[model samples]
Target: MPAQQKKIIFCIAGVLSFACALGTAAAIGTQLWVKGTILCKTGALLVNATGQELEKFIGKIQYGLLYGERVRQCGLGGRPFQFSFFPDLLKIIPASIHVSVILFCTVLIIFALVGAGFFMFNAFGSPYETLHGPVGLYLWNFIACSCGCLIMILFSSEVKIHHLSEKIANFKEGSFIFKTHSEQFANSFWIILVCSLVQFLNTLLIRFAGFEFPFSKSKDSGTVTGAADLMY
Candidate 1:
């Protein structure tokens, strides 16, 4: 590719990395990661509710890593409640797993910002003979992508295996036992997946910009003398 074309590629990748960072930050603040309905098993059994009557015993729940909103419908009108993970949910939920998810999210955002900075630097400035060059681009994007993957896996396990929604629904309730009726990952969870895909795409763009993968080139040719690298 021409020097001008390479700059354009790097610019595009930089913008994408920055956008992913912003999206992840926004996602962490919102309560749209997991959305589901919880059924009040005890209430339904007591009222002998069947079919359409069961609607009164079903409630809605949604949450992010830190905080969320839950509405209880135990044969009565929905009662809304808000919760936070730090100190409020430490006793009932799996504290270590939840904390790990938050830690990975923070890592993903930081690495994404670093990747964006490096991409812009490689495009507009003189290239250094160190990790700040092409190698750093690959390193940062890979780390961000890995963090994204881990966030999805860990959170999925916490929600499905640990019965997160049901636990939140029955948190302070002494009369009703709630069970997960329906659940799905909401927009914010999918946003992290998209960010992971974007990071992978950035790697391909770096390759398309004429930079070889760090170790794929033969050791004898590691000190390469190609037209691709001269402009940088």
Candidate 2:
């Protein structure tokens, strides 16, 4: 490819990487990761409650890694509550897994930013005989892609296999009881997946920008002259 076209491709990849990084960061901090309705099982099973009373035992909940909002309808209208996942609720929850998810998210964000910077640098600046060259593009993008994949895998495992939603719903305080009805990974979770895909595409773009695959070499096209050439 010509230098001008290569520059355009690199610029496109850089912009894409930067957008993915920003999106992943925003999803990490926002409260739209998981959205669901939780049913107050205790309230529903109350001796005084009838079939028509079940509506009062349902609540809506939405949360992300950092914080969440809940509105309970446990027979006394709707009571709203907000929570943080840090020191306050970490004590009550499975700390290790949740902490790991947060850590992976942070890693993904950092690597993504680094990859985007490399892409932009390679696009606009003269990068030669340095890590910021073609090899660096591959390295940083691969790292960012790995980080993004890990974040999604760990979080999905936490939510699905480990029953994170159930754990959160079952939190208790004195006479208050919480229960889960339904839950699903929301937009923010899917956004991380998109970020991962975009990073992978960026790697493909880098490859298409005239960089040879690492460790690959062209086969010798000339016939071997053997010892005759040495004698000459």
Candidate 3:
């Protein structure tokens, strides 16, 4: 292959990577938005559940993340406490799992790219050498990152409503129980969107190494790629 062709192939890989990144971001953003709505709605339902004066305060709690903060403000030994979506480090498990899968995929991609690149370089020993193998690898890595983003988003949506309700009850009782909730669409939406964007950007950087979009297929030919293979 010509020297120009090798560069072109790499560029194509970059574009594919970028596309994957975008998909990942979209998923995360949606998850965050859903979470916000869920929490706010839940709080409202509880506030009206008992017909107590505290019902009016549901909005207040939703607005400021006040319920959880109040628990942290609990004065005693001045112990610093924090609220998290999941218990201790366990909360991160789902996201962590997703991340882990992405990382593993990234490693495999790197290996494949290097092997392919090296093979092409040695085989053609010219501009064609550049076309080699790394392009496909980069393409796959982008896909993996995107997949991770999706997993995290789906997990977020599955958040247990009952758990949040109990937390609200604690706050209403004036007990300093640290609560983590999903409600208040504004905040939740933005957070999830931001998370998604970050993941997307990260994936883009890793996959594309910064390039324009609409990648053209490789000249190598013969091989089908699908979303299912990229993600799972």
* RMSD vs true structure, all candidates: 2.5, 5.8, 10.9
lDDT of 1 by residue, 46-128 (tens): 98999999999889999998899988888779999999987999999989999998899999999999999999998898876
Instruction: For candidate 2, give the lDDT of residue 71.
Output: 85
Question: Global CA lDDT of candidate 2, please?
Answer: 0.79
> What TM-score number comes out for model 1?
0.94
Which structure among the candidates has the greatest lDDT? 1
Q: 72-188 in candidate 3: lDDT tens per residue?
A: 222121222333333432333344543453443344334334433433443344322222333444444444445445544443443343343234324333423334433444444
Best by TM-score: 1
C-alpha local distance difference test of each model: 0.91, 0.79, 0.37
What's the CA error at residue 114 for candidate 3, in Å?
9.9
**How many residue pairs clash in each candidate at the backbone level?**
0, 0, 7
Ranking by lDDT: 1, 2, 3
Model 3 lDDT, residue 166, Cα:
35
Give me the overall lDDT of model 1: 0.91
Report the candidate with higher TM-score, 1 versus 3. 1
